[model samples]
Target: MPSSPNLYVYHRGEIIPLEKAFLHISDLAVQRGYGIFDFFKIINGIPLFLDDYLARFYESARLMHLPVLLTPDELKKVLYRLMAQNQIPQSGIKMVLTGGYSEDGYTPAAPNLLITQQPITLLTAAQVQQGIQVITYSYIRDLAEAKTINYSTGIRLQPHMRAQGAQDILYHQNGIITECPRSNLFIVTHDNQVITPKKDVLKGITRKNVLEVAHQKYATVEGVVTLTDLAQAKEAFTTSTTKQILPVVQVDDQVIGNGKPGTVTLDLWQDLLSLEKQQALVRV
Candidate 1:
């Protein structure tokens, strides 16, 4: 049995203690930083959007030319076993696919898969109501559509973000808004149109659901978004698996729609939370 302090991790074909998981130093994932990963949340013991997350994971592996050894069903079985072993009620599962041990240190070999789960701290409703400020950085992520393990740029900008008293860094190519480091951006135009960038960004599962729900009440567009668009917006927010939906009340020194969480942003937050709870009930 896996003992105290060591969470169970699904590695290759077996579940083992976290400390037992290892990868050779010669692995391309280590030497060249070639790897892909995906994350999904668990609510009330039910994995949220596991299918979507799995699809994304496999797609990332495919894009990176890393072969996935287990089928989707097999991976799900192992994930369930790992979850049962860890018994983390509200947490997130991280799936990593690494370019296997490389003899030449560049070519990808028989890829390695590692899945681990850990507890996550969620934001409170009051905190959501309070909203957060963000700083805009002129940068774009490499391989924007894939969930690659490369977050060097964002991690390097942590100090810059903190100095600006911001919670997250929004990436922009020129004046076009791409996305936040960990979340997708959405802004409601002064005319009440909801828009999120469709290009050069990860297609987040939460963003998809938010769009589906937003379409019922507001006009939605998944297309190009720019800083000028953000500047003229009446409401702004972001979405992610962990963030669910959070309002962005300020960007740099500019106050967003009266410097408070807008009605549209708050309403969408409530709707998304309700949807998640409802899905958890049915899925569990």
Candidate 2:
């Protein structure tokens, strides 16, 4: 077990301890889930790809017409202060901006901001090392590209997946691969081509980096991949901020590349880990 991390929360225009921050009774985010958020991982005291995460957060807020009450720099200060308050060196931080209190009606209102940080356990490390099985379900969310607070559908699917001994669940709609419940899926062909679900999926930061790195070694890469295409692949993997590069040993009872993490996946994982270390050192 890991040590408990102190939590700092930013609410309204003030920074408060996580235990002290409170939401108003009429906040629409609590009532209707009208909010957007971004998750970031801090490595060696520096946030990995924070700029990209913030950009996405702003984009989500814009799409929902949520006003940007604070600039990015101001938000950065809050994040660092939260980290300091929490005594967090390496952790995961989530910043949530939600529709604030409103009258007795269903309508938009002023927005509220809250940021929280906690230690990241990365519980899937063992699963990554030994590789894990994956199951795909027909669960697709509207506005698949936006990062929002409503994750009930994805949250609801985890129990059913855990009952089957699967590490995660990938979502598909009409035979088209959308994304995994928490991560993005990838596959490598027998011919060394790397394939992933196209722009339809959440263009994950780790996913983007993996594709960029794999381009140097693989001859062909395609983003618009289907279930049929994935099943035919020689190897498969999932990417996320925490998971980094986790190979998929099976997909819905079918073994992927001898039911083990493949050589290409291992190689890419090593490269990504090295890159992370390098980035952390440079930032420090």
Candidate 3:
């Protein structure tokens, strides 16, 4: 269950209750999984890097040829109104663009747009202290650059990950680490340099910010970080809009560097918070 019932959603140019938002049966997004989406977090009642996220959302829609039907300014107005309605200090916002309804065929008519906002729920202090375990899977997300509504690979891994008492699954291909189901993976080398997979992975908003801050202060490398390096690294963590910088104390059955969050991970996590507070767009 969600942490709260106060959800603000926008669909098809109309604001509606979350429960009232529905999709048609013949929608191409439902029938063929033809949809693009983006997710980001809010801070101090303000969305973080919304412009960047929206640009990528538009880019994905262009790649998939889905009609957005709203100008960026119009979309921003709707989004701001939705956020105001929710009235949360911080939240997670998602925008989904789907190929709209069609006849009894694969061809799409227009496109469907949806925006949802939920209160930002953070990991409890206990959870953070105890840390969480992660599992590795062979499933690699398709269209990694474009955040789409379809989640076939992640859906398939959920049951297995839960059965193993894990929170999420990290994906890999050809023995090279790619990313987690919903986060970007990073590792700290023996020399304390942060290493992350290059552009092949999703250019997540939080991931981008974290890397920028890390590079500005600490040594950082963006490249093909192999599974071998990840397993042997001094520390590991995953970054996302929600997770921020969560330490990966364990992978499968192997423990990473005393099976605890490393000093570098803690430093980067603090840096992330400082960066956000510094960059926050003050709200009235």
Ranking by lDDT: 1, 3, 2
Which pairs, if any, clash in model 3?
none
- The TM-scores, one per candidate, come to 0.96, 0.93, 0.93
Better of 1 and 2 by TM-score: 1
Which pairs in model 2 have colliding backbones?
Answer: none
lDDT of 1 by residue, 1-284 (tens): 33448688888768998888777898888998899999999999899878989999989888887889999998888898999999998999999999988889988888888888888888998989888899999988888888999988899999988999999989999899999989999999887888999999998999999998999999999999988889878989999999888899999988888888899888888889888888787753
All candidates: CA RMSD in angstroms?
2.0, 2.3, 2.0
Go through the candidates in order and give the clash count of each.
0, 0, 0
Using TM-score as the measure, the top candidate is 1
User: All candidates' lDDT scores?
Assistant: 0.89, 0.81, 0.84
Poorly placed runs, candidate 2 (over 4 Å):
1-6, 123-125, 220-222
Candidate 2 residues 115-228, lDDT tens each?
877778664556677987888888776676778787887788788888999988888888888788778888888988888887666678888788878877875464677888
Per-residue CA lDDT of model 3 for 174-206, tens digit only, reads 878888878899999999899899856878888
